[model samples]
Target: MTHRSSELSIAFALLAAAAAFTALPQPAQAQAPAASQPTAAAAAKTGLVDVTGARIHYQLYGDLASGKTPLLVLHGAFMSSDAMKPLIDPFAASRPVIAVDARGHGRSGGVDGKLSYDLMADDAAAVLAKLGVKQADVLGYSMGGSTAIALAVRHPGRVGKQVILSGTSRLDGWYPEVLAGIAHLTPEVFAGSPIETGYKSLSPAPDKFGQLVENIKALDATPFAYSDAQVRAIPGKTMVIIGDADGVTLDHAIGLFKLRGGGDVAAATQGFLTEAPKARLAILPATSHIGIMAEAPAIAAMVMAFLDDKAPPPPAF
Candidate 1:
């Protein structure tokens, strides 16, 4: 979702209702709309609905005739529904595809001045319920990846399969300096000043450096700490993907990889496969965190294939 500068002001106002101050500068561009307003041409073939609480926006494509399980795409932080655009056309051609703007991003509404994974999970549930979808193959990228895990834990019945891309089971010690830097920024700086230097250490594309900086700033600055035991409890088919070069010292991705066991795609793959034998991991050679999505079509294809396999069989003639 793209937001105009004016809408950013409104969003800041809304966000401030719960907190006393803001942490990030507004992006130079307006906030993307709450949802993509597809053209009539696209609308006829798709369904758009606003889930309750106005916190979830979903677009459904493809008919149930295929009997294929629906695929739900969730985006990373500070990103809008458009982030999943690359996979939508291909995935929707065979099975139903639904992409959402998580609360506080894109077109989704924020909860009463606070952002919590539980609330985000609730928003996902609301969207699924609104569509009357019993189960879906889910894939979340980056922040959405964590949100997807929360959904599986909170609403296991609704998840047929799950994929976590460049995501983590816990947030503690992930990026202390980055988080602290974001918290230190004043609302005025967040809304008008350039982003701090900490963000540059993580993002590959430094062109929109300020935007990336502000995005981290706008994210739920509240510290998030999750338990390893809590993550192990998530039930369903699952996979974890990460690049070798992610993090300050390559520790971010390496740590998560090690947490799964031994920091190799094979080891992580085996861990997940042991639980859900069908689960697998793909480590893109020479790919970094940000570069993985754009540079690694194979990874995306693998995810699409997993969703396809989980989809219900096509309807009979």
Candidate 2:
């Protein structure tokens, strides 16, 4: 099949998923969102810190005191830290991991307050400060990925090597259909989804799920994006990962990689030897927007490869 055909197929499929959002069956009961522990069994801690007009919620797995760089994991909009368990488990097993619930999300506060990507990124930094974490590697999915970019651009010192999963720096990076779907999102659409139930189970204000949905809609309506200079100026090395059929367009993903000093040339070309890209890009096959998050093991492996970064010695021929 042609590549364009595949993209259209994915786009239509994504639309179908979007339409199903409001049609999900209601849950029988709500329970506290599950706490995802490390596979290697590390000490776990949870905390709340004040940032801007909200209280941010976070969970730390593994030992902070070990002094190894921590990995900050940010969930998609309306998703709790708990829902990121698949990605968290493997990273936690290796080094420290911080899973955050953005303001007005999960167990955090200010459900109806104004929010910007810069503000959300600042909140993550504030949480790090409260916990006395100086710097961390970041892995953000969807909305979290957008915030991760802001964090790197705004608080360069607070981030180490970073990974952006299914994230776009500009809103236009997403397909128009996807944005339309997001525009149509109503509290009723989440009446029975984990996004709603998780909020009910873990939010400090359990009765505010509808308000949270409204907040997300408003947040999406606002234009939140970084300039080309801002993206090019990010000090740390970066890796951008996406599913073949993700909401982020292939062109945008390629643009991000290029903006970050990647895809300058083929790796083995002589020109590449003089100027290798400090960034990396991966497009996973047979994966969609939602499917990418669930493929944690594979994703974690790619993350570790980037983190480890053992390059072969240059040939002398």
Candidate 3:
């Protein structure tokens, strides 16, 4: 055949093959790999509850079937419910755990005015009431710890036991650097940081990031001071855990324990009893302020033992 004719034949053959391929029934698309099951920590049931005037976002791990006391967890400043992920699954393995994002943080709605510990504590109580939880053990870290103390004080009936990690009743318990950091929580301070990124990533009003920072700074500056008398009055069993090198001074933590009827009286009178004691003061060794929560394994073990009445009482000064 001539070159031109051969070319035409080849072209026609290619077209025919293309037509045949097109006519063939297409195989069904391979099912997209089933989405991986959520990790236990991420399997928490999340929801929003109207607590007082603000919408509170929360995560619940485990269920009532565990037959253990429910634990109400609160995170530190500039953090969300996500911050408690490390402790959720492990704690939930034995009991139901509830963690929340206070106003202006995470998926929770913000509020007007400064975010005082009293207001945050009230918010937590409101949330517990909304959840129909008559009483639950309360755990708080840093800012959350302050809120936990307020919760026990203001809504004493709602808190059966209180765990304050890296928390203090007095504002001055914090290191100067921490106070300075709180004072400097402007948008510029958090610029390009996870705090800023997290806020903008999920906030309903991302534009209000600057406002949130301002509110936090204001809250920090405003005194959330609880008197020694006030600390002495909290009715619930309490545990004050602080890192040896924490921003909360050791002396301050001792004062807190003493007010709770822990101090030297317990050590001298009670000695090292075989049973769980009412109040405790734990100064974790080789730890610092930021690592308090990150040391969840040790914290959880200590807390769980105390809650279960399996561990000895906290040592006295």
User: Mind giving the per-residue lDDT tens digits that candidate 2 earns over 197-295?
Assistant: 667888988998878767766766777679899999998789999989888999999999999988666674654354324898999887778767646
Tens digits of per-residue lDDT for model 3, 94-213: 788899898988888873545889889988887787777888998898789899999988998888888888888988887655565556444764566666777777676787888887
Question: What range of 10 consecutive residues in model 1 has the weakest lDDT sum?
Answer: 17-26
Between prediction 2 and prediction 3, which has the larger lDDT? 2
Clashing pairs in 2: none
lDDT of 1 by residue, 88-193 (tens): 6556656777787666455454422345676677788777787788988888876777788778878888987777777655564344543444444443544432
Error of 2 at 265 (Å): 2.6
Please report the candidate that would top lDDT against the real structure. Answer: 2
- List the candidate 3 regions with Cα displacement exceeding 4 Å: 1-39, 264-271, 311-317
lDDT of 1: 0.55
Please give the distance, in angstroms, between residue 169's alpha carbon in candidate 2 and its true position after superposition: 0.8
TM-scores for every predicted model: 0.64, 0.84, 0.82
Q: What value of lDDT does candidate 3 attain over all alpha carbons?
A: 0.73
Whose TM-score is greatest here?
A: 2
